[model samples]
Target chain A: MKRLVILAVLIVFCSSMAYGDAYRVSMRWSAKPGYLRLVLESGEEIIKTARVYHSYSLVKVEFQSEFSFDYENTPDAVDISHKGSSLFININGLKDVKVFRLADPSRLVIDAEIEKTANAKTVPEEPVKPYGLSDVVMVIDPGHGGYSMGLVGSDYKEKDIVLSIARSLRYTAGQAGAKVFLTRSTDKYVSIDERINSTYKKKPDVFISLHMSSSPDFVVYYAKMDTSIRSKDRYMLKYSQLGHLGDSVKLSRVMAEVLREKFKRKVRIISMPLPLLSSIGSAAITIELPDGKYFDYNASNRYALVNTILKGIGKYER
Target chain B: MKDNRYLTALISILFILVLAGGYIYLIRMHPPEIAMENKTEPSSQPVTKPGSEEHISIKLFFPEGHKLVMEEREIPRVFSQKKILREVIREFLKGPAGTGPFIMPEGVILLSVYIGSDGVAYIDLSEDLRRNFHGDAIDEYLLLKGIYESTISNIKINDVKILIDDKEVDTIGGHFYANRPLKQLVTQEIKFD
Candidate 1:
């Protein structure tokens, strides 16, 4: 009897060791325009089985296993459940709970907002305002710098070529009445995280990443949609992170078409999951210039490229 | 004395016959086993020269704008899959005779090709590919698409895993995600109205 009990205990221990440990969840909060964004960080992947819902003015995000919260009590997160494997946070005034995931140290983020029509007894009046390009903001980024010289061609370097173009673009875009911001003004090393953070700070209407290719041809690309996600999850993620994927695709298409029509250059538009463009909170695209040898740094050429992009953005208004 | 000499010669003949019989018995016993062992060893197929009458033609792909254009070339007909792949890549990297963009970087060299049972082709390229690439989205896309199209056209490959200097890179040109096995890009061709 004693031997059998010991064998059973050993089998249990081995099986548990083989499966490894479950995921632990940590939480943080940030302020958005009209709501609070609760971010949950997990060391392991947040699987498809994780559940999140709202009930009785409280947002409950439940996982299969228990976790610990290492965050201070914020004003947005009114209360939190400490029992069991569930997180019941009191979002009393907030409505419409949304959840999604981010890569590179996986995080399951949740966003909730206070609906404007929640307590309204009658239809609200719509306000119409004057429209101009003043509100439109464009953020341009030149790829690679510092130790990373990018691709060095026979005569010109990629970093120099792109920076010159981006500088030209900023000046030209100003003529079109759009506020322009460059991620790096000089030949400095800027990490992707810093670029993203800076772009987010500006809350720009569009983000364009400028780069040069080895081939003497131009190509445009939009952020590719992740097909692995379920339709529902994709919708939430697209809305939360990108805001409008349709706008991004349209922007890239228009930019490509405009470039092809004006410059007589062979241009192709593709969808790829480029981090700089994909993770930003605006319609974004990356424009790859022709090979270094073919790069034209003349004022007229840069002006033309900038004009083409501005024209493309004009179509977005219509 | 003559009978004694004849008896000695008979004994010598008997001794030689016994040795020969023993050798034959051992060979007969081990023949099947030795043959089976040789059969179980990996197969080595000889490469057929292009000049040979039985040589076959294989198509190689190159970048034409955004599309991959096919150009056929005759190579030594090698029966080994790995050998066939190596020859195909060697010819493909030599650039196509067609008047279009050069498919790869100027000094890029192919290190090796690994084909797995899961139909994934892992291509090892020299560091020149990553180092000399014109850090642009279109340039990287064209290079990768051309190589992928050429490889898939020449061989049966479901996915392509690209490795530069024996290490996987997050992005080839700081744009396209390349950490995972790349599938065929749909927008590789320009459609005319």
Candidate 2:
């Protein structure tokens, strides 16, 4: 009778172990506000949460088994596909993936892996409701334009590079089904105050300022500036959703990690007080892409950057 | 047994009283009245004769380095100001060579400067300025050199030590370092940007 009972217990334990083969994904925490990131064992399929500022808004979801999938953000849903053993994602119609590695508050890395016998089609696309009590809206600010070329490199101008990246971001964001607005689409000058005022009118869920570095060196740089303009009224309106201005630090880290992996370049993220990065009422981050001066901004680099960013948006889409 | 307990209690009380008496005696012997009075009073003024100590003012210049330091001294300022210090810094943003429209980008740079007691000037920023600055090395060199050079020249000091911000920086976006300090070449050459 004792032997039979032991055998029965062993069989139950074995079956439970066999049934539960899920990979554990872990994330490092920082004081900044943004989506929580989790890295899978495969280093290819990263899971991200919707935009969140308050700690109470964080949510964790576990998968039964690991699978390979590349994601692109669209208005209705995220387009996800798997490339055999690897994950290759396409955004809107753009191809290629770029990853950015950033370190400031801390390093947050997103990696994915493929599960055997699981096809890309098996993974379902789920719709996300807007963040907060109201609808989700995002403001995209392109850095430098018109007469202000910002940083001038030998081959490209900072204004042009940021504008292109911003346009791509806007397209992907719109496809993700969020209301997106751009401070300027053409090569025209918009005063710093005007940009701030426009963002205030929309009362966005997040603000992303796009810029490029002018360092003759090919290093990835990230900056967040502290602004003196303390709008008590604005703070009261968005404080619960946006947390504080310091959330930019978290947003920069997440975006930098994605950008670095996509471009395969030495990425460095910095924190500073600047008008554009500091003016947003919600979570804001400024991304400065390599200006192809010290480094070659070849086709691979562009595709990698675009694909990675789109995937990140899809993962973080609300 | 009751008689023994009473005797023990009496002895303990006597010991306590003796200790208290000793403590009070020590306290009375070292009273702080005199010391406290002295501390509360102020001292009288000092009288000095004319020409007992000589005061001198000196200026140091770095025309190319674009920095200046002014020192005023009684007699003992010589040894404190004459030590050798090394610094690695990027070139300033504006200078004679950088007067044109272009800019340079490159690596870490070294600069060594010296200071003297009398503050006379002799400075050197030549090829060393361009040594580590890349691409537009000339432009970077000119900017750094112009700032330091102009500052030293305007000051009347004969000797100066020009060190960049304490330690070595990788590359301020792609400039270079010379790694050595030069003597003051001229005083009038320093120009302010």
Candidate 3:
């Protein structure tokens, strides 16, 4: 009886060990206010590789292990195919994808922001008011604060420099008849999520992020639109969902011109991959000034810098 | 008999105290366990034994005065693409023999490299690369351009996706879009778009 019991226990243990790590992948999605959320629930952890084809506006995610798709349907992806051990999910009109994997429950969450044709930008041939910024709702975000000491010069930190500049700009821009909001007015640590959420919530018309860098030249960065159409597909260009890209580019150009006039040197305007600017859904740009050692921002100099930015924004408005 | 009972009670008290101490040491107040992230960090020595491995010549591009200067180097021949990439990246980080001021900061190591079936390579570098950025656009642009050019010249990969400390960051180079698939060839200076 003892031998029979021992053999039975050994057989059960071996079978359980053999089937330990096999799991099927179940996928489902739901609609949110501005974007859709895709949920991939699995018993096993996910190891994925994504390739973004900008011209096609499609993102393909490949999985390592061979798992059967237990769900029936999805909106963005159709005809889910398995090539050997790989499962590919092709998401169309994908603006950006933020993925999160939760522990305890063992599930993967994906937020997929889709590009819509309704978000196309219309830049007017001329400004509306041509005077003070009475109709502008602007948000000024200082780059770093608290312990994030951005760039260290001989005696000053980049955080302090940008904050002082931002504070001065707030005072000057507010005096010039613009309703301005600061993401951080003091020395505090703020996360990226908070910054994005605040900017998105406020629905500002123009957003300017200020910073100081060790770069020798003055630079302005605008948001890059991830979606693009094939060069031959001219008809598809109109339907492209380029939100805020046009206005951001125009604003960057305006700022570049203003800074060039003030500093009397070349100011570079480049498109960058800044999540803060991309998701703001408005005309957003980041202005990088030279290090503190080169450019001193005393009371008079601070006012001058603030006046320069205001001049740029005024140009952009009109 | 009384003495024997007292002795037994004292022994029980000591045993309970020992149990409490063990619990505190094992579970209550233990130090964090530090695990080695990458086991394949190249030592100063060659990957293989000196005379055992085959050698192949590769051209490495280093940032020299705003342009990438190609320097020929010989590396041990490895069977897999991942291994070969690791060797190449290690060599690139070591800088040129003449050492005319390499663009990258020191202590930057390649933690991991993963290449998917679609020929996209995910290269995870150490945190030093991200934290040591001094906000110089020229150095930033040249560093990435040189690394990408060197990798492409030796390998047949489609694109390279860079990750610092196993996480995707917004941008390392302030000018270019770091989040995008790095396929743009830098033939001329980075022009404003």
Candidate 4:
């Protein structure tokens, strides 16, 4: 009897072990003034790969294991598709997907902003007065803060140099009647998510990220997907979803031309799939400055670089 | 009294035997348990010989203008695919012989390279690649593209996945997402519409 009891207990324990690591998926959405926020809750770390079918306002979450979702009392009516170990959570009027991972309940939360519909019955809005470049809103992000020193030169830190340049650009751009915002105004560590969230929230007209390069020459980049040689048809370009990739490329070209003409430095414009540039709603470009012996920001040439960027912005709008 | 003495001696012998058995069990399990713990660390080595060296002609990619260009390079090649990838990357990091306007960030070190059966090559680099970025989006793009293109063109591998210090990185220089493996031959020539 004792042996039989032990065997029964062993069988139960072994069976329980089979389902030990099983996980489930839950979703919730809340309506805000301008957009809708959707949160997805899961037991394990949720996979980050997702595809948005804009026509259907659908988002497909790709995962490796079996999972289930909680559909009770959802704010928006969504179509749920569970096929071959993937979930397609489709909601009406989904515009953007911003994901956040919470540690408390181990939830993978997605904030999907809804697209606003045009109200034909409302009164026609009045035409506003014209302002030259005044309507242009710009966000100048100086990369790296606190512990993320970026690149450390022999004498100067990349964070300090870029921040100084950003400060100067902000003042210059503001004086030109444009509203400017900075990701970090001081020396503090901010995650990439916070920076992207802030930029997307602001929805600026143009976004320029500043960085100091350890390389000898300056570089400008927009957003493009890197191709894989081995991957089949799975690799796709992400810039199409960026929404501002066109503006980004155009702005990048103008900036490159102006910087090359003014500074006579080697400047190359390339496309990359950058989170800050591609994920944000605004037209974004990242400019890298040379931190070599000849490229000093404190010298008189600092203002020249700023003037060059300002000219590039003017050229972009024109 | 004699019966009590015999019982005591038998009990002591049995206790000693139990103690010896427990000690032997622990001794047998200790080494393997420690080995299991060590196995949890990052797989630092690849399934290839590191010291085998030969000569081969490989196609190298470099950043030229706004595009990546290919050049043929004849160098002392290593036998293993990982070593070959490492040597080629090191050569690219050393910069081309002529006035090529593109180079990776200074101080970036290649940690390890592991090619899987799925044709994806995991290239582990030091954190300096991320920490030492000086904010040039174009340079970052070119450097990453150079790595991707050079590896794929020279090696039989299909994709390049970058890891910083044996850990996955989200993005390098805030411009590109490094979380996924980059396919080879992906070009970013500026197209105006």
Ten contiguous residues minimizing lDDT sum, candidate 2 chain B: B79-88
Off by over 4 Å in 2: A1-136, A216-243, A295-300, A313-318, B1-93, B96-193
Instruction: Tell me, by TM-score, which candidate is best.
Output: 3
What lDDT score belongs to each candidate, Candidate 1 first?
0.65, 0.41, 0.65, 0.66
lDDT of 1 at B121: 76
Clashing pairs in 3: A127-A318
Write model 3 residue lDDT over A1-318, tens digit each, in one string: 999999999999988665444445677777632366667666644533322222122334555555556677655222245565455444433457777676655666767665431111111222333336776889998876544456666555565567667766666666667878888765555555567778767788889988775655688987554444355552332222145688888999999998989888668787654556766777888898887777764445565677788889988998
lDDT of 4 by residue, A1-318 (tens): 999999999999987665544456677767653366667766554534333233324566776566655667544224466776577665433446776666766666667665332001111122321224576898889887655666655555666566656766676677668888899765555667678778766778888988875566677877664343235533323222245667888889888899989888888776655656656665788888887455755434666666778788888988
User: Which stretches of model 4 miss by more than 4 angstroms?
Assistant: A1-135, A146-155, A171-177, A188-194, A212-221, A224-242, A249-275, A289-292, A299-318, B1-110, B132-135, B184-186, B190-193
Better of 2 and 3 by lDDT: 3
**Candidate 2 positional error at B27, Å:** 74
Report the lDDT tens digits of candidate 2 across residue range B87-191. Answer: 111223221232433332333343334333334322333333233232222233344444444334333333333333443322221222223222322222322
DockQ of each: 0.16, 0.01, 0.12, 0.16
Count of residue pairs whose backbone atoms collide, per candidate: 0, 74, 1, 14
| Range of the 10 consecutive residues with the lowest summed lDDT in candidate 4 chain B | B40-49
Arrange candidates by TM-score, descending. 3, 1, 4, 2
**Model 1, position A94: C-alpha lDDT score:** 50
Query: In candidate 1, what are the lDDT values of residues A117-225, reduced to their tens digit?
Result: 1111111122211223555798999887543456665445666556666765676566557788999765556776678778888888888888875566787877765
- What's the residue-level lDDT of A216 in candidate 1? 68
lDDT of 4 at A249: 80
Candidate 2: true contacts recovered, fraction: 0.00
